[model samples]
Target: MSLHDTSSEGRLQGRPQTGSQPAIALIDGNNFYASCEAVMDPSLLGRPLVVLSNNDGCIVSRSAEARRLGIAMGTPYFQVQRQLERLGVEVRSSNYALYADMSQRLMATLERWVEELEVYSIDEAFGLLSRREGEDLSSWGRQVRRAVRRELGLPVAVGLASTKVLAKLANRLAKTQPAHGHVFDLEAQADPTPWLEQVAIEDVWGIGRRLARWCRLRGVADARALRDMPSGELRQKCGVVGLRLQQELRGHRCLPLTLVPPPKQETCVSRSFSQPVRTADALRQALATYTVRAAEKLRRQHQRAGALSVFVRSNPFNGTSFYSNSATVTLAVPSNDTAVLLAAALPLAETLFRPCHPLQKAGVLLLQLQGEEQLQHHLLQPLPPEQQQRRAALMAVLDRLNRRYGSGTVRWAACGLQPAWAMRRERLSRAATTRLEAIPRVLAR
Candidate 1:
């Protein structure tokens, strides 16, 4: 791992070196997905923008302009297209590849700021600042944000606080208040309480809409009220999460930054159908399709599953013959090979298939996983060396072709006939960053 130490000179002052008074920093990309779009295309700046969810169904992300137009996140496209058209919103599908590439660059830029850090989400990262010496965390955060902006052409909001949750809140405040200049220092403020009191309880981390409503009913609608609540009572009501939030709001660090990525114990690929599916063949086809997707994810992660679990279920809300069944097939050898995994799933699919059941959803799970390198070789029986080599070559070729051309350049028949099983992406504009046809063209005509 290459490390870059670019601690800003102006930002480094009176930095403490103790774990007790640990300082934490939260850095969030401003308008992440939408910002990434603007970074790639300068023309997108200052425009009404929206990024669609799978199947282009709903707005997953929106630019500042789109937000001003009152476009809510997750608002279904079919419901908002007319209004969006009137507002002249530039709609695009969630371009994971483009966003991912930009995220990588941004994270790389941030690596210079801290010795220890954790990527909290695709667009947010946290770093430990408590152990550093002669570092003015407030200035340091601002410098880091500026560096990211300059290097990647992406703006960021940086927050420094005693705890993760407070840092998150500070980042929010930084983004909302231009006076902070995209950086917020909770510890630096002499009156952090006033700011905390003004924040709505529902807006606090972990407090959902329902939880906010419950708090509002009790007239406990602000962070100040939540902090004053008896610990025992809060625990009884909202449990440990509430206690953590209260402690965090008071500038107490509770959560530790995870230096390493957490292990994913299980992998799943499941989706509901817009319409009920009938016929054993169709159900099996859906299962197979899901299986292929699951295997692809496993391969991407460089992990192998020891089991293939397949399931088929009928609609629970249909009030009809509600049936749900699943079967797990333990692999003789853990593998990321889609063909091997799919073959194991075929038997499970056969067992789960019931005639005239009208399956509403189907999925596959890769469980009992292990690193491919750590997998033990068979003692009595093993795949031939030639076959192993062939599989490797085949998968490498498949990955290359898909990466170069686009996904599904080569696909299994089991993927099914252009079905709605695909993710909802109705509002997806042309693939502005991936497909050749979608590439922006300069027409001089």
Candidate 2:
């Protein structure tokens, strides 16, 4: 059935109209990075905009206007520089701080309506909604979208269905099909065959390029074909995972909403430097900075690492010479203290460093993480209770200061005063929500 044909007789198709069934909703922010930038500065609205990746290398995101202009995603910024300038397209470096702050606001707004929500990614969330008798999910979805726009000035598309996979498909249609009014509910349709046929197999959630190619070779071109494919053959070739996906498309819910996220197994902090560094001191500074970040993440999760790894690598693209090495050290006791992790990681950086090779990337990994409640005192190197208390108190003060005044307010001396190898974000926007100094000021005329 055409989405435009919404007559009761056509939509019902002998199936009873019911509203008591629960639904899964996939709410996705439209042009998330570009939307985030526009939220901060409304002047950029309706303009062709693109957000670049780390080091301002490639286009990671594009606004609707940019999409219409044929500016493909992942294109090298340098290659499109002249064209973008000629077309008067605006470009911004990836401002993660601003984007993260906007995402938090968006999620908080969604939590007000959803019974349970799973933050699937930085820009999308899966929500479980329990429908009341005679309730219209499409109406509820519109209200949610309105609230997000009013609160955060970010547009969203909502897709509702009995299962997650179908909800994902519905969400895609909600964005692409104007008749849905940015909200599509697959459960409301008596026969979803027409809609399922519209989705290509490759576009289905969890169906990667490899699986799509396999499906195509077997005459499965669209979502409906995959849904009705021979289960025995699918199971024989693609295993139980593929079967579960087919079941999901058939409106049998196999995936449940994750109300609570699992604890992180490890904390890693790694980055590519703006410029390559050849000195041992530069590598040490980079690793020390990464160690502090990893420890901060561990503390945030109320967890500590029992092992640490440090790695340094020269650019693989540099065909002249390439080098990569890593060193791991087992800690005496699980620790989230920056000083302790730094002490363990710095020496490894020194070991991995080669004087002649200009290393482009370095990182520190906090491994074998366990909750702070599971902390065990080492027999050989036991820390006194008072000393442990002091360390915890100091870290708390450091974190509090950083949160209030912005990051790097209090830092270890070893991280260096000014590192030339810092990330290149020349076009970065102000952290209006995060940093006090970056907040915009208005002047009355």
Residue 294 displacement in candidate 2 (angstroms) = 0.7
CA-only RMSD, every prediction: 4.5, 6.3
- The TM-scores, one per candidate, come to 0.81, 0.94
User: Which candidate should be chosen as best, given TM-score against the real structure?
Assistant: 2
Clashes of 1: 13
Q: Return the lDDT, model 2, position 430.
A: 92
Model 2 scores a TM of 0.94
Model 2 lDDT at residue 444: 100
Candidate 1 off by > 4 Å: 1-21, 130-136, 209-219, 238-241, 272-285, 312-325, 347-361, 373-406, 409-445
